[model samples]
Target: MSGPRGSLVGQQLRVATTRFAHGGHAVARDDDGRVVFVRHALPAEVVQVRVTRGKAGDRFVFADVEAVETANPHRVTPPCQYAGPGGCGGCDLQHADLGYQRELKAQVVAEQLSRLAGIERDVLVEPVPGDVDGLRWRTRVEFAVDREGRAGLRPFHTRDVLPIDDCLIAAEPIIDSGVLRRRWPAQRAVDVIAPSGSGSAADSESDPGSDPGSHPGSPAAVLVPVPGGVKQAPEVTEHVASGPWSGDITVDARGFWQVHPGAASTFLDHVLGELDPQPGERALDLYAGVGLFARALADLVGDEGAVLAVESDERAVVAGERDTARVEQLEWRAERVEQALEPLIDGGDEVDLVVLDPPRAGAGAPVIRQIAQLSPRAIAYVACDPAALARDLATLADAGYELDTLRAFDAFPMTHHVECIAICRPSSAIRG
Candidate 1:
């Protein structure tokens, strides 16, 4: 049962308990009061392990479950191979059951409420779900071709590159394309863009010094299937391909975008379903990207309803305005959300619905307070990271808003990334 005499430095151990950490990692504690953050571990399992990152005063162990010593019903075989150690940060649920993933996401929401927002509820909106096939759905990938010119993602928890022959999450271009197969020890990293939707990748306008988007003819675009069924632009012939999570629908190769093309539709549909925009309503879309939600809301509002789409990115605002020119009900504005709302503070424009699609850092305190001051009847918050969402929710709740509906979209299936939506309203509307 012992492999070399596990010295005091190499104490043999078992994972005493495991708990969910933000970004889907499982934090386990060992007998030595040292923490063994075994990726994808479940609670109550005794695991055999080695130490990867540790110090003399404290010990951290790494476990290779040679045997389950004990098992939890919540554990399941991971759906993706890169889900565990030495795997992509894309997914952390290989050892966790799917049902549990849903619950865990929901729990993270609930915990955020009590711990951050302070509105403990018996139930939350049923978490939106779809079948697996997590990786293959990604419509865009920005590969890092190291100085060696091999393309792939940064290694888990480090900057080292893992030269990949194929990425399960990447679209067809990244897989079969000759970009990664070539050699280029001359450069540090190069990006490869893939096409989204039914269109071919558009030629890229790249900065000369950048890696993947370095050339003007780079074929790539992060596909964004706008809600209520907006088709890809027919004349749009160019796309700037860049990196994962960076180029979903940006004019340039680098900007924040919702990753995972495979799950983009399912995720968008879920958000639309939850928001359920009504006609003749005035809506405010904050942090609005190249008008994804703005255009979608435009369709629902029709001629009678109006949507004010606000985005910080001047490029995205211009793109969204141009992209959704057909929608008369939408007005796109390029301005930081916090400053843009200054006029509304005095009760000038009271919107029926307010949607916040903030970055991982989330809406800071000022933004949260303004949302409350504006007092929109319904606020749909699309958050890419849970912890940030939780922190913001706490701020909103303290202002007397309650979480009416909360749902999670598994847009990034293989990686550790998860997106969530929270619908908040006055406590009077609290169902239970």
Candidate 2:
């Protein structure tokens, strides 16, 4: 409850949360017109907030709800015990109703688009098929290890770890893995992955010969060493099928894969629908993690056309190459997206379409400019963060690309995160 440097900490002020903002905070303005971002608060609620972070002469400060004077009707008790003040920093909107959380995310996305991109459109956040009321959807989770070898998650913006026996949003298999029951003395972190399938067992290097029946469908855990090499490395094969695209994807068990089971297929269907790839159209898939989108683009473009996939992670590229070997039309470039994009554009290859699924940072102005110079008829951008997407869309708009269609998905239920699919086309082509 103390601010940075223990100054201005514990200063309580009554304010009404006016609206939702990025990064899981609700916006409020003090009487002096200084901005205050209140956590664990909802829009339209009047609450007493205790300053948690601030500096002298600062225009804004971060605070936590000390007490709600007027609570929103949609606010519900968080399902997880370690989900409030001084609890784990995993889920931010757990206090809100599931449907309300999606609505808030949609509002955040729309606001970001309107403010940053100067574009306005009706935004509907459609829910993914899986998950039980926003519970048990995460297939993977990384737990931080304290100095005492206890496993837990870090508190928000702090190095302190709060021990937890179970995560409500984690898949059932991950909870059954008993990862929380064990200690990780030599490792600073541990990743538990529940691969798709039933009747599997938890496998860890610490307990090599452990029985599989200890917890049916238990996930596999890999130790992340603090200083030395990993004690045990694990790889997982993910099977995905969506909209004429079906295949098995190989990735490092600890690497980037959609935590939600239905996220990949759902995003793929939307991306493909937006791009509408032709049978013999050459395409580029930027930031192609494990070649998920690139594989689908290859299937659509056929052998006569080519699908080039560029990724920064070498391990991801290796796995992508191995998993996509059967698709001869697909090519993998193991380099940073910006670096690879320059040569592709300089080479003057006629790119018919571009599919980019950038990380949370999103592809910045430089990358967007290069893609625009390629003069592709259409570009499909899959963004996980709305603010980043808006910034990049503004750059694309400046480069003479117009937003054709946009769709948002409630990919990470019970959380502030939402996925957006944006389709853009060259203004000249649209005019023609």
Candidate 3:
């Protein structure tokens, strides 16, 4: 094999994978004692690696397993054929068993906390309710369109699209939608969503007391990104019947919604329990996408209390406004979180509780300091990335806040992504 510059890419070396690292690679050391992150390999396994990218002065290089001379017991054949080296990058930890995957994720979380925050805690990753052996639980998926109009996924770290008949990790509705078989010449990417009540195999066993009759009206919503913007397909209403709040959330087929079938309810229940908002308290829901958390906050605080939701996305804000319109106590602000937080903090309104579900970037230190200034009795942070969460938590620590409770969930099975819910309180309160 040759590299991009006609350089030899088949340079092989033997190394034993020591442990799992963030972003799906397993840690190993090269002959020169430099770190080598090997793909398609597992911990404690002896593998011959083909260097993908690296040079002498570099701190680390990346490689793919040429041959697994020794395999770990926890290693399993990835369910998806396009999951190994030079395959789809959608699911990284599929090579490991489901239980081992969670353990690896917990280890990554603990390492990030200890390294970044100088704090350590027992990390437990609870499984979300749905998923048949972690095979088909993704309610949303995006496929890349190749030049020939073939709909497929991009290979690991490359723009090249690999066509396939079906994605095993996709929910039943998405797989049955026949999206992979379709052509999208004019589109760069296509998004598929399996809203609630789609009757997918994962949703076969409905929760007790859930209105099983509420259908999603469509098996899956297919959206295509066009030249001007995203061309919307049919809209889908996601029904939620979970702790404290239950209703139908209307979202544009292309809008942001939890991809996991059980994530919305699971995170909501956990956050509500952690915050334990009291009636007549003022709350702020930052990065409130479609008002999922804001609606629940409004219910917890009641009519006497007030909840403000801030979001930068115009479409999401418009949808959030419509969804929470009946709740007079909740108001949606279509502005960036950092921009809106300053004025609210300066307004002298006492914020009792704040729930922020930021993007993968996580809320930076500036935003965390502003939130600390609000002096909310309790703050709930929902994070999709552990490293970003750890950095922000360290920043909050500098502002005199202590991490009270933290919980991690296996929201994205078969992938390295894990969701964390962190509760923080003033250090004085902890000392009191």
Instruction: Residues 107-183, candidate 1: write the lDDT tens digits.
Output: 66556656766567543323223333444555446555565555566655677777766666565555554555555
**What global local distance difference test value does model 1 have?**
0.61
Those runs of model 3 whose alpha carbons end farther than 4 Å from true positions after fitting are: 1-10, 197-229, 232-234
Q: What are the runs in model 1 whose C-alpha is more than 4 Å off?
A: 1-14, 32-35, 50-83, 87-89, 95-100, 121-132, 198-254, 262-264, 267-276, 326-328
lDDT of 3 by residue, 77-175 (tens): 898988888889898888899999999999999999999999799899989988888778898888887888777998888889998888988987676
Compare candidates 1 and 3 on TM-score and give the better one. Answer: 3
Rank the candidate models, highest lDDT first.
2, 3, 1
Top TM-score model: 2
| Shift in Å, residue 252, candidate 3 | 2.4
Arranged by TM-score, best first: 2, 3, 1
Q: State the number of backbone clashes in model 3.
A: 0
Counted clashes in each candidate structure: 21, 0, 0
Query: Candidate 2 local accuracy as lDDT?
Result: 0.83
Judge candidate 1 at residue 89 and give its lDDT: 52
lDDT tens string, model 2, 1-432?
Answer: 335664666788899899999989999987778899999999999999988888656789899888888999999999999897778888889989998998899899999999999989778898887798899998888888887777899888998888889899988877786678877676677777776632223354455666532454543432333324654345677778888688778877767888898989888887888788899899999998898889999989998999999998888999888877788999999998889888877898669899998899999999999999888999999999999999999999999998888889887887789989999999887677
Better of 1 and 2 by lDDT: 2
Worst lDDT run of 10 residues, candidate 2, spans: 219-228
